[model samples]
Target: MTKLVLAADHGGFELKEIIKKFLAELGGYAVKDIGAYSAESVDYPEYGHKAAAAVASGQAERGIIFCGTGIGISIAANKTAGIRAANCVSEYMAEMSRSHNDANILALGGRIVEPELAKKIVKIWLDTPFAGGRHERRVKQIG
Candidate 1:
C-alpha cells in the first residue's frame, strides 16, 4: 500500500475529512493525518510542515495539504527541503504536477474547490506517473 500523509488548517478541516473518507473508500493507501482536528482557527504552516516532514523523512511516499486558497499551505510545504508541493485546482494541473514536476505533495483549496472536483484532481494526481526524461533534469534543478 502507498503511504500518504495529510494535513490541513481550520479552513480546510472539513474537506480534509471528506478526502480521508474518499481515500478510505478507494482503499490501497495507508493514510496518516496530521491535523488541525477541528474547524477552529489554526495555522496552515504547522500542519503543512508536519506533512512535508513525514514525506521527506520517508514515513510517507506523498503528502496532501490544504488551506483556504491552497497557496499558503503549498508555500509552507515547499519550504521544506526535498518537498515539491503543487497547489492544484484542476485535474489537468494535478496531472502535470505529478508527471512533469514530480511533485511529492499536492495542495488543495478547501473553499475554492468543490468536493467532486477535488476528488477528481486527487485521483488524477495519484494515477499519473512522473514522466522522466527532460523532466528529470528540471526536477533535479528544482532540488
Candidate 2:
C-alpha cells in the first residue's frame, strides 16, 4: 500500500481535512495527517518538514502540503534532501510534477484552488507514473 502524508497550516487546515477524507475513503490510500489538525493558527514549516522527512525516510511514498499560498510550506518541504516538492495548482502541473520531476510531494494553496480542483489534481498526480528514461537524468541533475 502507498502511504500518503498530509500537512497544513491553520489557514489550510479545513482543506487539509477534506483532502484527508478524500484520500482515505474515496481514494483508498493509506493516509497520514501530520497536521495542524484544526483551524488554529500554526506554523506550516514544522509540519511540512515532518511530511517531507517521512517520505524521504520511506515511511511514506507521497505527501501533500497546504498553506494560504502554498509557497512557504512547499519551500520547507523542498529543503529535505529526498523530497521533491512541487506547488501545483492544476491537474496538468500535478501530472507533470510526477511525470517529469518525479515529485514525491505536492503542495497546494488553500486560498488558491477550490476543493474540486484540489481533489482532481491529487487524482491525476497519484495516478501518473514517473516518466523515467531521459527524465531520470534531469531529475538526478536536479539532485
Candidate 3:
C-alpha cells in the first residue's frame, strides 16, 4: 500500500477528517495523520513542515496538507528541500502537478473546496503518474 502523510491547521481540520475517511474507504493506502487535532487555532506552518519532512525523508510516498486558502501551508511545505508542494483547487491542476511537476505534496483549501470535489482532486492526484520526458528535466531544474 502507498504510504500517505496528512497535515492540516485549525481551518482545515474538518476537511482533513473527511479526507481521512475517504482514504479509508478507498482501501489502498496507509495514512499517517499529523494534525492540528481540533478546530482550535494553530499555525499552519508547523503541520506543513511536518508533512513535508516526512515525504522528503522517504517516510511517506507523498503528503497532503491543508489551510484556509491552501496557499500558506503550501508555501511552508515548499520551504523544505526536495518537497514540491502544489496547492491545487481543481482536478486538472492536481493531475498536472503530479504528471509534470512530480509534486510530493498536494495542498488543498478546506474553505475553498467542497468535500466531494476535494475527494475527486485527491483521487486524480494520486492516480496520475509522472510523465517523465522533457518534464523530468523541468522538474530537476526546480531543485
Least accurate stretch of 10 residues (summed lDDT) in model 3? 10-19
| Least well predicted 10-residue stretch by lDDT in candidate 1 | 10-19
Better of 2 and 3 by TM-score: 3
Q: Where in model 2 is the C-alpha error above 4 Å?
A: none
Best by lDDT: 3
Model 2 Cα lDDT, one tens digit per residue, 90-124 = 99999999999999999999988899999999889
CA lDDT of every candidate: 0.94, 0.91, 0.96
TM-score of each: 0.99, 0.97, 0.99
Candidate 3 segments whose C-alpha is farther than 4 A from its true place: none
Candidate 3 or 1, higher lDDT: 3
lDDT of 3 at 127: 98
The all-Cα superposition gives candidate 1 an RMSD in Å to the true structure of 0.5
